[model samples]
Target: MTCGRPMFPGSTTEDQLHLIFKVIGTPTDDTWPGIIYSEEFRGYNFPHYRPDPLINHAPRLDAEGLSLLAEFLQVGPTAQHFLMVAISEAVFESFGAAVQRLSDLSSLFEVSGISLHKNPGLRSSATLTGRSRQGR
Candidate 1:
């Protein structure tokens, strides 16, 4: 996607996180609600970083693409699911339909006893299964 240019090409986990923070900004409790609960992150004081606009990092992306990329880069399952619904609606119907589609999908998932937040792997499995069934 980056044309072989790795975005945050750091050699170690900490270094990678720092690079990500430099661009995406440091995660806050609001942005990353459960980060403080992680054993690896607990008590570690990460330096504050203000978000650098994506254009500063990926100059090739246009405004619309950057907007979509920002949504795709969101931190949690709920955000990611919303991004997926938004993208699907944008592609298959009108963007105005996204809210309704999201509601519909949420209700469908609830009825099916599928929780994307609890088992993210099911999303991958379902996607793969759908692709296979489509003979794609």
Candidate 2:
């Protein structure tokens, strides 16, 4: 857990979804299959939001924690699981090496037809880590 508070603190389902979207951005057709078929969602037009940096919401986390959190927060279950395995194997690597491994994994996922935008948090995490380790 990055912060000691709930990530999405909305009491109602709709409100909670809005909160989630505020952080992770709205799901597109590529991200959510059959979403168009939902009558409830079909009538509602959700605002398009760019995914925010996890550090913006969870400033308590360090680069390593943010990197791990980013991997676990991928859109689809399969992507999340895949990254989980990769992250587990990366545990033995140094912080810089692990971040590089995650970047490589992101490239691999994209090459394998997974949308790169599906994991903006990872990109943001990597960027932040790079900035923190400037000149290293």
Candidate 3:
């Protein structure tokens, strides 16, 4: 959403660490589950911080778009959506007429039981050679 440089940047590892503390703050069980159990987590040494709201990062987005963006930006592994389903949902949510046209097109092929996946390669070489002879 930000499309900006890293919130935490530094010349050295420790400097970056300090920047992370300043920007993202310390990760807790609630903010980042299982972070405390990670091998790299050091206890009580770094300063704590709370992140700014998502709205602050994407000031230009409208309320409806922001809500959808929030759903896609959710944390944790299980929060993820299937790529195709997410795209379809976004398209339908954002463009009603286009979604309807796509649905109509899909119904045209549904009766044939043939899928686009069945043809996976380029046009046959015979087709290419035939085209070359047509101009002769």
Tens digits of per-residue lDDT for model 3, 1-136: 1222343458877677666555445667776688767766663356666655556655555787566655654444444444335546642333333333445235422422212221224332111111223344
Clashes of 2: 0
Which digits, one per residue and each the tens of the lDDT, describe model 1 over residues 1-136? 4222567789988888888888888887878888757778755567998989998876666787688767766764468677656556443232233234455346423322222232254332212122222343
- Which pairs clash in model 1? none
Count of backbone clashes, every candidate in sequence:
0, 0, 1
Off by over 4 Å in 1: 86-136
Q: Give the TM-score of candidate 2.
A: 0.53
Looking at model 1, residue 30 earns an lDDT score of 79
Where model 2 places Cα greater than 4 Å from the true spot, the runs are 77-80, 83-136
lDDT of each: 0.59, 0.60, 0.47
6 Cα displacement, candidate 2 (Å):
0.5
Compute the lDDT of residue 82 as modeled in candidate 2: 65
**Model 2 over residues 19-108: C-alpha lDDT tens digits?**
888888777777767665678876667788778998998786789877766666666436656664764555423234434345643542
Best by TM-score: 1
